[model samples]
Target: MSDDLGFGKLLDDDGLVARLLGKTCKGRNRPLLYGPDLPVVFLTGGPGMGKGRLLRCVRDEFGRHVPAAHLDCAAPVHAERAAQHPSTRSEVTEALRELAVQFGAWSGDGGAIGVPRLYAGLVAVAAGDPLAGQAAGLDEVRRHDDLLPKGSFWGGVLHRAFRSYLAALAALFAAQPLATPLITAILDELFERVSSEGKATLEDCYGAYSGAAGHPRLGLHALSVDFQQGGEGRANAESFLFRALREDVEAAYTSVRGRMARAGRPAVLLDHADNALGRRLLRPVLLDRESGHHDRVVVIATARRADGGRFLYRSTDADAGVVTSWSPGDGGLPVWQRRQGGVPGLVAPARGALLVGMPTLTTEQQNNEVARLQGHGGHSGAAGHGARSGTSGAAGHGQGHPGPAGHQPGEHASRLRVESGIHRLSGGRPRFVTRLGEGAASLRAPDPAAFTDWDLLDAPVRSRAEPEGRPVPVADLLLDDLVTRQLPEELPPEQHDHWLDLLSHLSVAHTGACAQHLMQARQEGRDERLSAYRITELLADSGWPQCPRHFIGDRGLRHLLMRRLYRLRPDGAAWQEDHELLRAHFAARADTGDSGADEPCGTAGAHAAHHHLAAGGVEAAVDHLTGAFPLRDPSRSMARWCEELLAVAGAPCAAPLSGAPDDRHARALGEAPPAGGDWLRRRVDRLLHAVWLYEDRTRPVDQALTGTWRPLLDRLGEEPVPGTEVLTRTAGEWAQLAQERQPLKPCACTRHLG
Candidate 1:
């Protein structure tokens, strides 16, 4: 109805909302809305930042020429209705179903009809008797509609119904003059509503169709809002998507005999990516440029500048161009944040992309927005009337900096209005700036400081450049509040403790091992073992975001064990106890080390050594292993410890084997020493074997063994080494009990029978 239908007004006080509405540098560009070859514009922001409102504006402006599709990714509330009342007609559904059936039947060449075929699986589901009762109220249903009729029990099975839909839409999606690019835009709190499994499947579908570059025929954009634990879950979701894209690209090329063409690249817009889910989801994507997947996809995420590294991962370069930053000097203030890095190298890089930093509202804009809120002659919070009332000055109202009160003589330049540095407070994450600000305001904090505690803010900083500080996980804070009854007021004490134990234990070990520990602890009547069900219930109680069901996949038990094990301190005695328990439990199963536990002990040890060596030298290698396992197998452990000490050792020694000279005779300790003549690895091997050999000596020791033995023992003084005492005693006990001892002797029964 307006002169320029496409341009929409944005929420003035909220930069995040404004950005989502396409109100930045490139906001007004017609190419984004109408083009022969429209470059996909990914609109990203956090929850409640107006992504949906902006999308509606796009649709209103572009009309049929824009031809955009908006997908609500939130799980269907009335699934039955959705199934019966599809968005398109039944003819299209039939066409898709036939296409699916035909495609499945076709040979390789026949299936490549310039368009993908659809599957008919859903029709059968729709027609089945099981849903007959629910369909009774469908008398008013339109027969040919795409959506299922009302009251149909099987209404919203779209995902299951839509494998065929996507295939059928492939050709439509690719057509030019799309006005909308047959756009498939999904807006949802994806991590919260969908099961992890569903997320994974969706990712796989998108990834595969994109053919490594992206869906050549369609434009796909996803906007998701995230909350606390949701960030990690979202990260898992994104990872699945990325991995799917990677695999799909490979498969498409292979299937088409390298004939597959590059489609429009996919992009993701994340609102407020400051919490765990946001961080986990965005980190890898942000770091992807450094990881060599340059051309496949691009991800744009938002975060507050103050939350620091919570939203940043290791960038491929020190700076990836847009908004390049430089360190501040002595005064903690600088002329401008320096731009020191090159642009991120992207594959099929966005043809035209712009990164704009949103600063605080201008004086005039701020005043206008405030005026609108006040209304003409309406009651103000502080006064009954106009500007001259008993209203407080800026200080009293807690607003500050109205151009330094009175400017200096030549400093109209000072009135230029610098950024409020609000970005720094929110890590430049637009959504967070808006939300936290709003939250602060709702609480009527006189200043932002009144709403946010400095102690809490200063707790820890997790930065890529430094590794020492601990991260204050948002999950932890949420859990703490839940425990303290700061929320809901319905959480029981036992429920709170259970949740704490689950999080703590899972944090201590790998997911699989933790699950097993919980199971074992639970089976033995320790309700405190932090069972998955119990943890889930507690999380549900505490309002922590739910993980996708598929994220656990078929590995539910494994996840439980690993999470519980991870909860134990790696350096604590509990760690060893847990590891041994896991090893024993896994060993009892039909297949030990099958699936998650496959690597053999010796092989694992060797791989670790090789990994260390590859990183640098023998000492460095030794240190890594020692750090991983400090107590058990001291010989191996000490060797590793010594190696690290040696690598970082200071002073002036460039010499090899500086102190010791070899005085012992030749000793073939094991059947084969390592090829590189690695003495440390060999020493470890020899010590471990000696312990085993002594334990088994009651049976027999070959001449070959004796030859290896004398030399190794000669290196050791006879009084039983202190560190080896445990091994010696165990071996001694086994030997004393066996009673058929022999010293380097062959069996008499073997030589004379012939």
Candidate 2:
């Protein structure tokens, strides 16, 4: 479990633990700045984002400072134990008992937490049937008798009436066959022995049970009554357990000594909490918290759903809504300094959950991670060996490595390239970084200087871990981990097989409608495919982060899908055919009054041009781009327009064609570049090549690509397009933006890190 849950090597240096703890007000000054509200937090990220591991790290590392207990909702132990029993009522009662015991034992003061109602209900149920429950009733009493106060509650009752144990207990049960009245009487006697305050809180909370509203003693009766007639009634009893558990936590944490030792709110770490059990538990918590029943427990749940579970979160639709997702990007501020950060406000729907993400590795962090994995903890780049853009291990990840000034001549440059390639391929995602790094470590490279791009991106993962496991490529692992394997969980089990094939085809589309167009066409004569909108929802639900413009939102996922479509079959005609489908689809929709002002390639012609280029119809792609070029609103950002146009054409058909496709329109991206004749064609060709250079983020900022814009501006100086002046000015700005996006060279002192 620890091996599976630990990613602290990647996350420890990032201070994610401290940051999350700070959000929960672990060490804040008394009288919290925000109004008395600590929003329930859902720590969310997609697969490979390390949400569960972060929870474990926090629990083990900060156990003393924060009275935190981690519960795996995905595999709730008590729930499973209760599943062996015949009654659903046991689930609510047993779960509350477990929660009470977990929270009860952790108090700083000598205070015990117990659910007397649940205990009394269990005893009463067991006592009613002598054949089934006499032994069970005695077992329950022996197990939790210590949780009940010592003096009168049990002593007076058992000594006075039930001296022979089962005989007297069963005789009492015989007096009342129904569980409700008997359990109520038992608790009423037990309540007299506890502290007046604990009695008051329990009585006040249980007094609201509509089944026996007037008598505070009837709470256990209410639960026992529901337990007798098992079904939805038993399930409804689960909702009341939180109120019971929370009141116990409040009571135990109330002692002056307890507050002094651990003054902050205790935390509950709910891992894999987007599952059915999690939803069931969280829905009631959310409803209770929303209705103003606050407590001293801070819930930090992990969710695979990117936006968190829909029921656990309501994204406050108003501007003043508060959700604290503090990141390293925010200026360093103590938890106390942030104003109204995590406090849920009075906005409509008042944000039910605060959704924060685990940080993906930054360039420097990734470099350090690779260094650590490859048994070179200090090596990021070899300073003085020609790699100048690298920085030292950020946040002090390691004992700094010696500069590779004396190593093999191209050692620094080679390492620099590998690091850049890995970051580009991985997008700094931690799991991918680890896989690629482990893959690199397994390979017997003579020196850091000799590694290749393929070794880092498509590195062997399984052959290292298991003797019989095939050497599945990192990309395929990613495809399986992120998409293919998640389909059953994301969609109906029956749809998983067919939906995967449909998604592969829809990868060529730029938007949902475009995807649907392709999907409907592919499924035109069959009922195999689901509605396209539902498919899009499935992608989002599975946490395939979307960019709205592209149908497959994740860059890495799209890259794998695109390569598959192009390389799966001989000649890769399916790639061109799919692109042609999109080309024709968008072509018909071109010039319609549906283009969004903000969508640079919002015009159908531009999208058609994009697919045209992708499908190898370069001439038509250029024609469409050229035609759409003049239609931009000059007042809008032309620089943004250029950036977006670059994105649309976006290094499509990155590698040149091999065998030919038959369609005339397929010539878009398949041909050799025109031999330096047409200016726009040449410029477009250069722009595409230039965009390719930006893929690797940590690579040297190629100022030389900046020169590509110079020639474009120079060409526009002579042969003007419709928006030439705006284009010329925008060209320089786009050039600068390109520079802004790339990692720049580091100073002499930090030259060995990234």
Candidate 3:
């Protein structure tokens, strides 16, 4: 029910990420200027900034019309080939073959293949052609070679057989060549291997995979790994890969242009060209071919800033590929930031070049996301604070959305915190978020004290925490040998720290207290300030569930405060000092004290009367009943806890009530009706106080209110209380107040006192 924003889910599915990226084309202007068509176009950016996802979008939009191939550079490939060798035609060919088989080509029997068989084959082959010694629990394939043959690796065999079958079927096309033009696609990591090769191979055929012919041809579209490559090794991988992949891509592009008549659009989309690749790799791709520059291919590159050196490469000739940039900020800023700067502009000038930035989600779009998460409001399974990530709040939620009519009363809760944007947090880097999401929520729950004993929380420098607290063998880390095993491995240290810190703070109820305590401890040198800030920053940047305000009551303000705190740390010492300052600031805020009106209408000290009752000590049954009254509010649900404690201690319940019998009679308790007149109001008021208490203290609910129940219930019905609306309805229904003749003012024991 909390409207806090931490629930924004990850852009997990590639399809979703693609959708988000397409929205980035806001201006809808000319095609964005990127690299030349003759050079390989490599998209680069900080990890999770939408490089892969953007490629998927381009593929979705232009793929069918052109023989385009999408390669996920993050997929695992054969181990020996992955690290030991550069991208070979054979490996790429094998990958293309696997994609074809997995996506569904004819079977060797010339019959339609099942999607499952193809998918399984892809997973197996992608598992990196496990050695014969490693083929335990796998179906053994018949092979002529001692080890798996080139085309006989589990994935390779499936692909080769599928290709032949598909080729045979394509013969039926007559006009459209039986051989599918090889469109080799690869993501950034795999492309790094291609860049290392420094050349292209395979021929004939147009599209990305074409290179040398007679053998299987090659044409490739690949991402650049500038961030990952060591500077001394390859200062700008985009340039290197672009030049290398371009040789083949251009040749295939020419073939496609000739065959198709209209010039084929051989496009390259480069994301975040401000990095090293933009400088070294982008010049050739962006240059115009009419003045001896590379021509015929269309290149579209995107960057955060067009003024950066990467996009500033200059040739003497004028109109060298129109240099225009698209900026999203012009239209409107996203809601996440108040008055945020407009999106950067698209930097292409060609009339139909189609350059644009992404579109920001409208307010309605954002609200729809929120509504989907909160469950059309007032419905069951409406995401109670304790509900699991994606489930109904009610027990009968198994019967989810029945038809399009509406959500049934028992429908499970939809996921909360829907986040959508150009580089959606969830879809673009699903693996990263999924890993964090599945593991983090529990770690960041409102209970930091519980985590003190966690083994992962106390991890050593070189050790990885057990994912989700499930024991993962250290040896398993060794198995992650493929380059694609962990894609997008280049988050800025600050952003990484932001996410970590956010998670840590969310783990406690009294986030303000935790912050103050941590800061004070740092000032006292009891805890390392820089280390804690680093941890907090990493979590925040990663979009973990961080309290928006120091207090849960103002989560938004808290988030902003946390951001300010993080930004204040210009240097290590500065950061530590800032922590000290914040410690003092918060201490002062807490000392200001709650200054709300002190009306005690619901309370019956009549002031002095209650004091006298308490003086009588634990045996003052009336005092205990009065103190315990507030616990009945289900909104707080604290009453049940108190009831059990009293029962266990064998406490007396003969509280002073205007109507109930004296302490001497046992059956008199049953004779009185439940407490009335402002009872619900007091309960609600008391409940409000408890929200803050539950957040800051460790007192058991039962023990805290044993002698304060009656007054508390009376307070609960007060206005502005959290559960006021519900309590009002329920209380009236219980009292039948509307039908009562005497405006029923009852005693603490629920009997009419007037």
Candidate 4:
């Protein structure tokens, strides 16, 4: 939000976030437009980027203005009404029921916007075919005459149906374990009652699902069978239900936004849309929207990944699956881009799947929040640390860094230090910054200064730091919330330690193959104990982004795990040994192929170089980058070339180093001795140091590049993207932001590496 959105106010912005973070057009104004627009918006980001919180804010903010409903698709039906029928399908059905009931009650100046047709269908399903058939149906309708909607359609058929409809109907849904089949029957009868015009609308909507859509019974039957039997078809059925819901939305809004041309479109905030149920609900809607059907309702789904999962990026011959991302720093939307092997010319503005990456808390944004949270006008929101923060996953309290109590009552330098420390530590993640802020605030008691209490708050997050007590350590929170607690949810308690071990090892993995190799090596041929798919899925399910290039997506999670690995043994053998395992795998993959995977051998070679560096094989990493691509690329292989170089330079640090390279590191480096093997060895250390400088996001680009990178560039005779981008921009060839001149800083992982 442009305003000082306090901690947890994720959606207070007036389209500033969408404008800045996504490739969404101006149509995505505050309260987002719908109908012939990007009908579905997927809020995708790494975990802790505040997607769920944003969804809640949207629901709360828009419910007052329009017909809006929120449903967390990941959660199963636990409401008392559906407690007996606790299934994901039942959850979907209950949520749909709640939506219909809610919107059905909504009224405008013209009158009510009830989903009479859908209601009739639900009542019909709940009413079922009585043992006395038509006799019980008539009596049943009369019993609830006041409660039912104004309709005689169902009563006429039930004139001879009244034995014991209620008990039998409950049994029908309850006996089946899932209520899909019974619900499908209700849908069939509802469709039968639809007027000819309404049928045409549905026919057009469901036409894609069932290519030729004449028979309502046929369509409902197919959906019933598929929905009853879960999988891809289950998603198809959910998609159909959504279209059915859209028919209601259009019918509801037609009297207002359509005829009156005044009111806004309705919205449905769906959290965890990348999960099993959400994907199902969104699949057909996306397909239909892509095929040129514009529904009325605005569907906003929260996804863990910025692309909203692989369904959007799973390339096929007819369509390349990657969705467009307006990742924060990009100048404009590129013509085509994908993480790996995306077919050229297949991606464009015409594709479906409207996805937006959740923007990180920027240097300015974080500073504003701290100022706003401090409950004072004096926090100075304008005085930020830097522009974009390029953290080196350097999150550890080395020693002597003052905690919350160490500062004096009115000391200005200490205040700046606290703000800078938090910004650096959090790496601009909203959740991390917010939690750290809360913890820091907790230190205000007993004494105005932090004193010894500050160390507890400031200690670098470690695995054993346990998130407990009056004010939990940030490291303990990361360990417990990110790793320990989440383990039991996916795996059994006995396997928690094993998976934690596996996860720690994965902190060093640059790719999924690297992760799989770590899991295999740790398991030692006991295939049952480890499934590459399972472990990788575990990471994704735990809310860590599962990018193939980076096995564990979130930066802080990896740093946490890496520290734990070093401490697993006194000699740091567990940390070093894991790197050895990955080094060997990449070395093998580079020589042969990527175990039937499609990535080129060059990628394997690069990965090999990274692991080699992590295992202290610095010469190998340098040689790989030095020889891999042209030093100055006219073709500009800058993206990939820079990625590998940064990867090598940013290998897991064994020591907890933070901020700029000062005199301490200078003394540690000493001199390269001007010749032979020692020169190359010094270059190895400087190669790493240059990377740290380039990646040190807390400082201005000019300052970060000027330190070690300038010398490293001349020594290696190789240029990287940062060298050019930082220099030209610094040479006054480009417009510079006010925040760009701020001076250098440092930052992560779940846990292990030597």
Best by TM-score: 2
Q: Mind giving the per-residue lDDT tens digits that candidate 1 earns over 1-754?
A: 2221111233221222222332322233121122122122233322222343444443344222211223222213223344563332122233222322322232232122111111111221122222222223122121222332232211222334433433333343345333321111111222223344444434444433323244211212321111012344324333433443333333333443434532222223433333344444444444443334443332333332311221232345343233323121122211222222345543222222222222323223322232332232222333211111111233123344332334333121111111121122232222333322322222211222111122122223232233465544222232332233222123445555444444434432223433546455534755534455554543333223233311121121222223333334543334344434443443344143332223222223333333233222334333434333334344443333322222222101101112222111122355554345344445544533443333222112223333444344334323233443433343344344333323211122111100
Task: lDDT for model 1, please.
Answer: 0.30
Which ranges of candidate 4 are over 4 A from the true structure?
1-34, 78-89, 104-113, 124-239, 255-262, 290-293, 321-350, 374-378, 385-410, 442-470, 479-499, 509-517, 525-553, 566-573, 576-666, 669-754
* Location of the lowest summed lDDT over 10 successive residues in candidate 4: 745-754
CA lDDT of 278 in candidate 4? 72
lDDT of the candidates, in the order given = 0.30, 0.55, 0.29, 0.51
Query: Per-residue lDDT tens digits of candidate 2, residues 1-754?
Result: 1332224432232344444443222333233322245566676777777777777766765544556777777565656776655443354455555555665466433434444544444554433322345335445444554344334342233333322443444456566554543344445445544456545555676776657675656766675566566666655556666665666566545656455544545667887777766666676676666667777677778876655755544455443334455443453422422232344533322255666665667666777776677676565334222222422222112223443555444334445555655665566566767776776665553233233343454566774446588887766676676666555355776676676577777767766667777888778877556777888777666655666556776655666676566665677777878888877776777656545444435556667777787776766765554444444243334444564466555425623233333232112232445554455565565555455444323234445555666566556446533556766776666666554443221222112233
Weakest 10 consecutive residues, lDDT, candidate 2? 743-752
The superposed Cα distance between candidate 3 and the true structure at residue 751, in angstroms, equals 50
How many residue pairs clash (N, CA or C atoms closer than 3 angstroms) in each of the candidate models, in the order given? 87, 12, 118, 43
The predicted structure with the larger TM-score, 1 or 3, is 3
**The candidate that achieves the highest lDDT relative to the unseen native structure:** 2
On lDDT, the stronger of 1 and 2 is 2
Instruction: Give the distance in Å from residue 691's predicted Cα in candidate 1 to where it truly belongs.
Output: 49
